[model samples]
Target: MSQPDNPLYKTETASYRERWIGFIHGLQDRICAALEDLDGQALFRTDEWEREHGGGGKTRVLSGGRVFEKGGVNSSVVWGKVTDTMRTQLKIDGKNWFACGLSLVIHPVNPYVPTTHGNWRYFELYDDSGNVSDRWMGGGADLTPYYLFREDARHFHRSFKDAMDAFDTGWYPKYKQWCDEYFANKHRGNEMRGIGGVFYDHLRPADSADADRLFSFQQANGNAFLPAYLPIVEKRAVMPYGERELEWQEIRRGRYVEFNLIHDRGTLFGLKTNGRTESILMSLPPRARWEYDYQPEEGSPEAVLLDACQHPKDWVK
Candidate 1:
């Protein structure tokens, strides 16, 4: 696919904060619509909820589909007084804070089709007089396939690389390395969560013009998600799978659950800030299994996946 253009750059009259909020909400709608069309048999059920402290969000989920077994595309805009918890856990030194973002995870029923995840968020910290003190942007898209498909992994990584290269030629390499490192089960010998794509955090802009550019960059990545993933889903969603593939998928999902609960800062931040319990944990797969001393046979497809996890590949290059 071609590199995505940043049409969202400098096109809005709204303030930077408002522009991000509007973009995430609109993105949620667009993504849900496209996913429904892809699933063919399932629809998203939305829950519009408010946080007791400050802002609210819309959580849309789809379950029991012909394609996807369970998935969630959530948008949240939450703000409140910077509490002791925030200071201690998130290391913010502001009196007040505001945050908005869209986070999503799709778990396909067919093991041949990889599960995908993407998130794009913006945050601000305010001082005593309610002036913006500090702010930054964070997010990226990654793929987690139970079975290795070289072309599918390459397509997934290349699409996001194209998006980042439009912004900066250096970013794809930097963020791709960060993703391989960040989404790993460190306790399990640094095994990656998937054949990594791209990940970044704490992208502080130097000025307003730079901030607009960053916002546009974020939009570029967000817009790239469907293109990166949908084609792979379409290609593999029809492939046959049996009990063996299903078993391996669940076993790998168990590691996915491990990374989120134990190592993910997003999960830790949400819980520490009193974010919604249900929405915070929506990234978990519908089913997972842990078997003691379980290992795939030598030279098997499952073993190939395990090997890739242990040694992250430069898929795009």
Candidate 2:
């Protein structure tokens, strides 16, 4: 999986931050193109808006695709004063701040394959005198599949593992476990979303060595997306599906909605801070249904799959 040479890498005078933004922009464009091509139907609606306080973002949403029911790829470069409530939550001393980042969520149409969400962001704080006070980087990717695809799960996990291994052998298992734990629905006795994907946040630059290591890790994971996902989508998109599968998918989507709305910190932060409503809610499935205590028949493959979603596996092994 050789990526096309990134032009941003060749720029000599651009600051690291500038280069990062350029890279993100290019990546977003490429992803949107790939998705549109694969879907064979143009479903994306590009949206632009200004923040009430200062800056804004571009939100690209695709819905009613042949493969994906709905998905959103959005980027925001926003800066504003941090309220006292925010300071309390982040546990930082800051009156004003600047934050910018790219985030995306892809929800596929097929019930067999999983849904995925990821975001990478940079945040900085400035003193009243305009001097840099504190800064840190945050973000990670996670996978949520409705029905299990063993090889697809293996491939997804392996790609992420390779990325983490480049930084540290311990990183893959550690962060993978963190992802499993983080996305759990505690109200439902800690039922997990999917098997797992690497997740980390609140990373700050240490010495040069540590800073470089963190940057490398971010790059590796960011680059891992296509290999982790595209093949799985290709394999499953054309597979025959029945009404039962669709029904099960909708039921599981209900759980997905519950987790995002009730438990996800990212969703909470976005809504609390006046983030774009459509963009924030774009992580939801295109269609979903909830039936009281609905249970698939015992010993059925569908039931087995639902059991697997509730209990993860060692897919790489």
**lDDT (Cα, tens digit) per residue for candidate 2, span 270-316:** 77677889888988887899899888899887677767767867778
Query: What's model 1's lDDT at 14?
Result: 26
Runs of candidate 2 with Cα error greater than 4 angstroms are: 1-14
Write down the worst ten-residue block by lDDT for model 2. 1-10
Error of 1 at 194 (Å): 0.9
lDDT of 1 at 203: 99
Cα-based lDDT at residue 192, candidate 1: 95
User: Which whole-number lDDT from 0 to 100 does residue 137 have in model 2?
Assistant: 74
User: Each model's TM-score, in the order given?
Assistant: 0.95, 0.90
lDDT of each: 0.90, 0.76
Clashes of 2: 1
